[model samples]
Target: MSKEIRNDSECSKTDDKDWHQVTSIEQIEAAIKKEFSDESDSRKTVTAEVKNDKANWKIVLKKKNEKAEENFASEAKSLKDKIYHSRFMTTIRAQKAERFLAGAAVVLVLVVALVSVSVSTCYEVLVDGENVCYISSASELDAALKDLKAQADANTNADMTEAVLSTDVEVAAKHKVFVETASESELAEILQEKVSWQVPGAKIVVNNGESVLAFATLTDAQSVLDTLTQNAIAANSGAKVLDTRFYEDVTAEEGNVDAEDILTPEQALAQIAEGKEEVKTHTVVSGESLWSIASDNGTSVSTLNELNPGLREDRIQIGQEIKLNKIEPLINVVVDKVVTVSEAIPYGETVKESSKLMKGETQVVTKGVEGSKDVTYQISEYNGTTLEKVTLSEVVTKEPVNKVVNKGTATVATSSRSSSGSSSGVFSWPSKGTISSPYGKRGRGFHTGIDIANKKGTPVSAAAGGKVTSAGWSGGYGYCIIVDHGNGMKTRYAHLSKILVSVGDSVSRGEKIGEVGSTGNSTGPHLHFEVIVNGSTKNPINYLK
Candidate 1:
């Protein structure tokens, strides 16, 4: 029988099924071929055909029960189980790796924090086996120590010939966490305060008791004493030194001393010479005299003069520095010596009576000549001052000649009237004028003469008959003339406008020798007159007639 069948796109029962029905075997084969066209499909299928009367046919589909399908399903199920197991294992491993990385990060952060808080490398300085300070590095500590030593060497008060620290210093590296560190400058300051220096030195002890000076060495101290002795000896060069010694009981002790106390040779000598007493001085002010200065300071003018040698009482001006105290050396060097010196012997004079001349007139018969002699003296000097001098012997090398003079015994008539109507005494008035300034304490100094005021060109006469000894420009006396009378008496006429007499010219009493005028230290037209007796100044008014 022939059957006719058709495939439906959608049928109520076949639409929900995966199989389709066909009419012929070729059609059924085509349907099977079409359904299994994809070779990758593992689905198994079973086909069945149903025929009814009047040529009606239909194919039905059913699941095939094949071993291959069963094996495939079993294999697929096993493979799916394996895949799920692999995924689960991978997920677990990833989670474990993430957890380990997180733990590692935490450990790394902990390590970094520990490293930040750990002790850092530094240097520790020790002085005399005791810790002094901490610094940043060893090199820095070394530099600081060197700088401290340099500072000690540069100190002027210390003799640093072989400078060394009093205390032992050391540096070491150390790890410190929470400690204070010092900078280079601070470290140097710390070392300076903690350290001291010592040097080989000598102490000069006075009177074998107290130390007076300190030197770098014993040789230096001895040299100072030697120099002082040499200086004292040099002042008296030609003398033969008999003995030399120190007045003070001085001794030098050699030992180690503080560096600051040590001094150079020069410094030690100055200290010994300056002594222990503080020198005092006074500055002269306006209207102040040496007497007033001495009285106010509780001292004598003679003491001031002795303290300050070459100090003139009248020459002291404003702002002159006058020493009130004397400078006495701590040590006095006593030097004893013998000296021989040549001296001049003065000649003597003899008078012979004569009746042929006037009573005041005299004539020289023979000129006197000076003689020389060698004198030996024993001199004891203390610090350049001669403390004692004794003449041992004197030998005359030449005898002096005696001067013979004839004295006049005849009397002659003369005028006894002066310009002032006074008696013509031994000395007459030198000039015709009014006395202005007297021969006494005129101001701050002695005048030594009398000032006579008159008009210019007034005649200045010799006080007595004598020979002109000096006639020239004299200091402060101007164009002056001096006449030497007999019997060690002389007269001076100064501040002259003109000098008529020359040296070695003879003049009588009331003879014009010069003209009076203002010259040199004079204020106006005047004649400054003076009388000198045996090289000593006498008041002009006392001798003037």
Candidate 2:
């Protein structure tokens, strides 16, 4: 008879059944035989089929069982043994279990003992804000209080009523005291109320006390006030005190309170309380200085110094604030006339004496003194302003003298040069030359004179008729000639190769004074000329024409 066989997929089994079935090879093999056999003979052959199934199942089961056995043996062993053992894990596991339970029991007993033990606590007592630390052994809060009082001193002024104990803190060691420190303000309040009696105002105003009697006299008051102001007291306040008291005995009339008696303690306090002074602004008049402004305001230099510390040492600028200790208002003084003088007045002439004199014309030419007119002035200032007629004298004469001169007719002599002061009038330049250099600074240096570079040895003529003051070698100005042309005017000719005039000799406008040459301080042959007006060098072009 023929038979048909079914595969494992033909069965309706869950994963758990499949896994259980895999665990038993005999039951699986039996199920396979029953499901596949069809006849009696085949049924008999089922045994044979079972035997083959068993052989095939045995190989598969052997692989699965080998892995399971190795894993189970490892799990059942002690952690140490699993790391070290090859197999036979049951004995190691039992031994490991015994050790684990023994350690757990020992730890459990220790924990129970610690949890059941009773511990002693310590506390600090504060009586009236005073900390009193005490060490004691007590279980209850009330018993702890009893132990604290017994530990502290009874004679002390500490009251137990309304006392406060610190938190129930456990004793760290067998016998240890907890400490609390008293606060600063609490201690200060205690000292203030109970320690000592303080006398009011017994302490000196300044710690290293100063003296009032050291300033004994009124002079002493002035000295003290001066010292105080310099040391930082307001200067005006110091000046007020000094001005009131400094000359007390000398200035005070016999009866009432002298200036010395004015500055009492009350007055000094009042002065100090008024820290700043009244700043007085004043418009500066012409010719007014800081010292003058201070004086006009009836205040001293020191008060002005205090007012404007910005300008510590310099003169006060116009329209500045100048504080004043002018206890009384200053009286304004009015002047009826204002005359401005440019030149210095003679010894006998003053503003008063010169006030009545008038601008008179020349009468007798008694002194014949030369006087200047058309003087520049700021006279237009007081025109509409309040001023009387301000007259100024033309001249002041006390003595007079006269002289006579004899003049002869021009002698009939041709080309005869004489030192006659006939040409007293102004003269003109005798010759002309191209101006080579100007009377000023030349390249890299000062020239001091005009340079007229003419032909070498050209006759240099005088620019004006004058008496020769010098005619000689004058250092860098070799063979130079100088002429004083009267009326504080003079002329010079320098770098000359030849000089035709001698000192004290008179020359005409056309006369030859020297010959131009490259004599001294000359790059080339050139006549260096100069014009002096009133002892000062003036531009020669100004007088050339």
Evaluated against the true structure, the overall lDDT of model 2 is 0.43
Q: Which candidate's lDDT is highest?
A: 1
At residue 449, what lDDT does model 2 achieve? 72
Error of 1 at 10 (Å): 99
Residue-wise lDDT of candidate 1 within 1-545, one digit each (tens)?
A: 22212222232321112232333334433333343333233333333222221221222232343534554454334322332233322353455543433322111000000012233466889999999888877888768767766776787466676777788888888754334689777887888788878777787788976556767778887888889888878877898989888878988788766777777778877877787788999999999999999999999999999888999987999998999986778888888999999999999999999865434557789999999999999988786577899999999999999999987664322333457856535677888879899889967899988898999999998777778889999988989998877667778888899999899998766778889988888789999888887788787665655
Clashes of each: 0, 0
- Cα deviation at 8, candidate 2, in Å, is 99
Score residue 420 of candidate 2 by CA lDDT.
65
Runs off by more than 4 Å, candidate 1 = 1-150, 153-196, 208-211, 230-235, 270-281, 294-314, 323-330, 349-369, 402-545
Q: List lDDT for all candidates, in order.
A: 0.70, 0.43
TM-score for all models, in order of appearance = 0.44, 0.23
- Model 2 lDDT tens row, 1-545: 12233322244422323323332334434333333222211101111211122112111111112333454343223222221221222333445543433332211000000001222234433334444333332233245445444333242222333333322223222321112223434433433232221111111012122212211134433443444334322322211221112111112111212112234333433443343344456776567777787778777767777655765536555665555543321111122322333342222211221211111101221222233332222221111223234344433333222322222112111211336623322334533567789988878997777888787888898876667899888898877889876667778898888888899886756678888887877888888888776777766655564
**Candidate 2 Cα deviation (angstroms), residue 333:** 99
